[model samples]
Target: MSWKVTFRIYYEDTDAGGVVYYANYLRFLERARTEALRALGFEQARMLQENRIAFAVRSLSVDYLKPARLDDLVEVSSAVRELGRAQVVFQQQIVRAGEMLLDAQVRVASIDPVRGKAVAMPKEIREKFKTLMGTPA
Candidate 1:
């Protein structure tokens, strides 16, 4: 299922021209993804402490479709697109006032925090991710 997280644009999230900085959209997407995982029963601190693993952004492709000015209320919709042994791909879109402002595909790799090498996602976590992606195996 898709997760929707709403956020209001702040001065810090914008540029001098009062438009959201292009790079900040990535950060917004990241936060929404984290919240989505939390909704799926994964917390970053707990995952790191118990699984010895953390997620790292492997790649991200973003399309800027429109602009959101300061004080605009935007919602970020995120969902899993693919869940693999070592990576989870997510689709995210940022919308404001019924208009899509940004669209993105983000790939995050599961890795051992200490060794910094890739690893399989935990079975329970993988199951939830598959369910979220709606391609359960």
Candidate 2:
């Protein structure tokens, strides 16, 4: 299943031309993922404190199809496309109303903060991600 979150475009999210700055989309996507995990009962802060595990973007690719303007309400949707022992690939999109504004794929890796190395996610976390991978969006 896909997880979704909505955000309102603000003046700070846009350029002088009133269109969302390209880089800001990354921030929006990050928030969507963070909220999705939070909704699943996996708080990032707690995960770090308890498991010493943090997720970092391993790779990302985005296709900008349309621009979102200031004052627009946009929705970001994310679904698990692939799940690995230590990483997940997410299929994501940003939409305005029913129209798509951007398409992206983001790969996130579980890492050991102190060692600064990729590590397998805890079993409970992997199982939780499996639920997202199996459901239909």
Candidate 3:
């Protein structure tokens, strides 16, 4: 199951050719992931404040299959693919209507903001993420 969110491509998301810039796809994926967390009652800001930890992109792989033009309505779908003590792998896709435009796998790591090093994810947060992973979009 996956979490889905829709957004329109604004001019700012496009390149000079009027197609979405390759990098903007990453931004869209991030937005979707954040919203997914929010839907599960997790807020990044509060997580950082209360847990003293933050999530950072450790690595990502993306493939673009189609181009999205400005003003096009796109949907971003995200799901947790793997979970570890200190990291999570997110599978995400960008689509127009029912057509997939891009797909990516992003690995995010939990880090102690003060020490700038990896840390275990809080137990409650981990449980919530696991629940979301099995839920339908």
Candidate 4:
């Protein structure tokens, strides 16, 4: 099952023409991922506070399948597509009602908060992610 979150497309999220800006979709996808983590009981800020580890976007490749306009209620569906010792890849999509507006695959790497270098994800967090991945919780 996919984790879903919805948000309104505000005017600020759009360009002068009122279509959601290309870059803002990335932001939307990020928010969905953050909320997904929160749903899994791992808050990024608190994780950094306790483990000194944070996740950073390593790379993103998005496909703009359609345009979403201001006032549209868009839902972003997210799911963990892959997991690694130091990184995770998520497959997410932005949809307006029944239509798909965008889909993206994002790679995020766990890093040491102070040094900003790659680090293995904590086992507890990994286990939590596994639950989201359809393994036994």
Q: Estimate each model's TM-score.
A: 0.95, 0.96, 0.95, 0.94
Go through the candidates in order and give each one's C-alpha lDDT.
0.89, 0.92, 0.90, 0.87
**Per-residue error at 63 for model 3, in Å?**
0.6
The predicted structure with the larger lDDT, 2 or 3, is: 2
Q: What is the lDDT of residue 43 in candidate 2?
A: 97
Model 1 bad stretches (over 4 Å): 134-137
- Using TM-score as the measure, the top candidate is 2
Q: Which stretch of 10 consecutive residues in model 2 shows the poorest summed lDDT? A: 128-137
For residues 1-137, what per-residue lDDT tens digits would candidate 2 score against the true structure?
88989999999999999999999999999999999899888999999999999999999999999999999999998889999999999999999999999999999999999999999999998888776663223
Q: Which portions of model 2 show Cα errors greater than 4 Å?
A: 134-137
Residues 11-72, candidate 4, lDDT per residue (tens digit)? 99999999999999998998988998999888988998999999999998888999999899
lDDT value, residue 91 of candidate 1: 88
Top lDDT: which candidate number?
2
Q: What is the lDDT of residue 105 in candidate 2?
A: 92
Write the number of the candidate with greater TM-score, choosing between 1 and 2. Answer: 2
TM-score winner between candidates 1 and 4: 1
User: Which residue pairs in model 4 clash with each other?
Assistant: none
lDDT of 2 at 76: 92
Count of residue pairs whose backbone atoms collide, per candidate: 0, 0, 0, 0
